[model samples]
Target: MTNKHSERRVVVIGGGIVGASIAWRIAARGQRVTLIDKGEPGSGASSHSFAWINAGAKEPIGYHNLNRRSLEMWPRFATALGEDVGLRWGGKVSWETDPVAAEQLQARVQQLQSWGYPSRQVSAQELAELEPALEIGPVVAAEYSENEGQVEPQMVVDACIRRMSELESLILTGAEVIDFDRDADGGIRAVQTDSGDFEADTVVLAAGTDTTTLAAMSNVYIPQAESPGVVIRTTPLPPLLHNVPVVYAPPLGDGRREIHLRQCADGRFMIGEGDQESLAEDDTQSHADDLLSRAAQYLPGLAEAKAIPVPVGWRPMPLDGYPTLGYTTETPNLYIALTHSGVTLAPVISQLAALEICEDVRADAVLTPYRPERFATLTEEQVAEMAHPRAGHR
Candidate 1:
């Protein structure tokens, strides 16, 4: 990538991890960038993120490879940020108590191994030795995904913002986007924000839940499913899991979901049940306490920890359960980036998005499956129904 786009102005809406990463990447590549956020950066869905960077759970060979590519780029990406973004790589471990679930786990591991991922079924002894802190209940079967890991989303966002500042990019917080100014051909000419107006050659809407509404202003349709998740935190405790960075303990009984636990760099444990994009709406103190107590069934050390209930955070879920990326047909210069695994996919997504915006090249090879135009045919009633549980649109 050269400085050919040095004269092009890039305006990024949304200051979450995705937007921040794209802003910094665009700015660093010599394009003039303006980052606009309605509130403090990284204070939205990112704050409530589990921050577990992984690819094992992703499906479909292409999408899995996309996440795996970004996962591999994390270390170098963190290095480029010039700060420790609390990236830790010890892999993810999970076990099952039920025989049926154990069979499912075995098959999952086999499929991952066939994909060349470093995932394999581990014995009960190996699982115990891997994380001696965990009190293995009745492990009928278990597996370890060695390539998966976790990171600090806020630290990653801050690092990107710092790099953008060093590149002389402008950042506006608490600046809601009121509207957009269109050019003769109907491309975004400028962004009208409460903070002020910012002219742009390219406008990237990476806003979390608001991406749909913002894109609709330009006649671009992007539908999203309601994804409310809760990942409660515990009061900062001493370093808990020594070897594995993440643990997926089996449910206590028949009617429970699998609980995931990971100790942050600050020693606070983030406990959440279900997959990264699973819909969990409970954020009450009782739910938080129950989550912690269930985690304690595996990691006895957490028995004394107090659960801190966080508000239910709505994840940015494209209707099809994949990323909505690249330029739209209605607005060629308007880029749409909305995804469920933004934290894990940030590195590769930002780099490719910057390439498309800066060099005037399309990343169709990797991003063709996630174009915003895919959602162009939805009916008015469908659009109305899919917009629920969304945060304020900019």
Candidate 2:
């Protein structure tokens, strides 16, 4: 490894939305950037997510503020980049059964109200008005956030890639990053790939589910739990539902899982559930029938809607439901960004990561608590030991 200061290049090891967003940000700052990926661009989990711009689940005023700020930042990228990105500003709904759970939702509404977001509790009548065809099974109450929205995940990533191309940032597909070599001063000098070595002054590991493997090459451990989410798209239907309805868990004695369903701009409806868990890598399975059966129970109109396609992907879930972002203590000039709601936060997170790289500081307060080193207190051996006790160690 050689001194990194000799070059002003940045190597982004993932070409998904996370890496593409960061590359655009770094390029905007007049820095040379190269994005490398093991497969075609935007074909990873970013393309597989529901692309829901969630707001209700993110409580605490600070987190809401981050979402709101990102919302403001999203349109600029879409408009300036001259791509549709399939971004729609439709609102979101969070309804639940169980009287006690309703009370908890009311508390969440109050919390959002304190944050100054227009989140209101709605009666069954209002819910029906919003979706006349919706079969609200015992869900008499709901919370509606007018500012929430959704986008076609792949479109967003494609738009980012187009923007990067326009900026002359090099993008290499089918490039597998095998190792990260640090200089004597502890700064990342180059990323060794199967094709060749690409030198860089900074490196960002935003490789969604694959981050843990990349971290191991640098001896940086990130404890990632894989959550399998299923997404199903229905055949085109006339515009029946105006707003996206996100129902919390337990679909009111119907023996089905709760999910959010919204009519896409193309007239198709998308349904999703995050209930499946996978212990092995490469465990991508489409639970389309389960999702469709449950979704049909909620939206009776879906009985007529035929199942078009189903896509399942893995979301990297960290302990405490938080993400690992920012620089790692194990290596310098090496950064990581992994989160469950990567689609919703990618715009802001990427901007913040690039800011830290270019300006030597991350001024975003929301990012202060999400540094990757939060897991530094625990070693991999310790975590393994805790998960599995020494069987024969007397």
lDDT of 2: 0.72
Best-matching candidate per lDDT: 1
RMSD to the hidden true structure, all candidates? 3.2, 5.4
**Tens digits of lDDT, candidate 2, 1-394:** 2232324688888877788888878876777889999998788887666777765566455666776777667777677658787788757766778677688889888887887777899887787676676777667468777777777777777777888787788889898988877788667789999989999878888888899898878878776754656567778988766565343334645564466677676778777653222222222334555566777776777777776555456766654356577887778788887876777787878878877887787664668767777677877775665433221111
Q: Over the stretch 270-289, how does candidate 1's per-residue lDDT look in tens digits?
A: 99997676678889999999
TM-score of 2: 0.86
- Model 1's TM-score against the true structure: 0.95
For model 2, how big is the CA root-mean-square deviation?
Answer: 5.4
Q: TM-scores across all candidates?
A: 0.95, 0.86
The local distance difference test score of each candidate is 0.89, 0.72
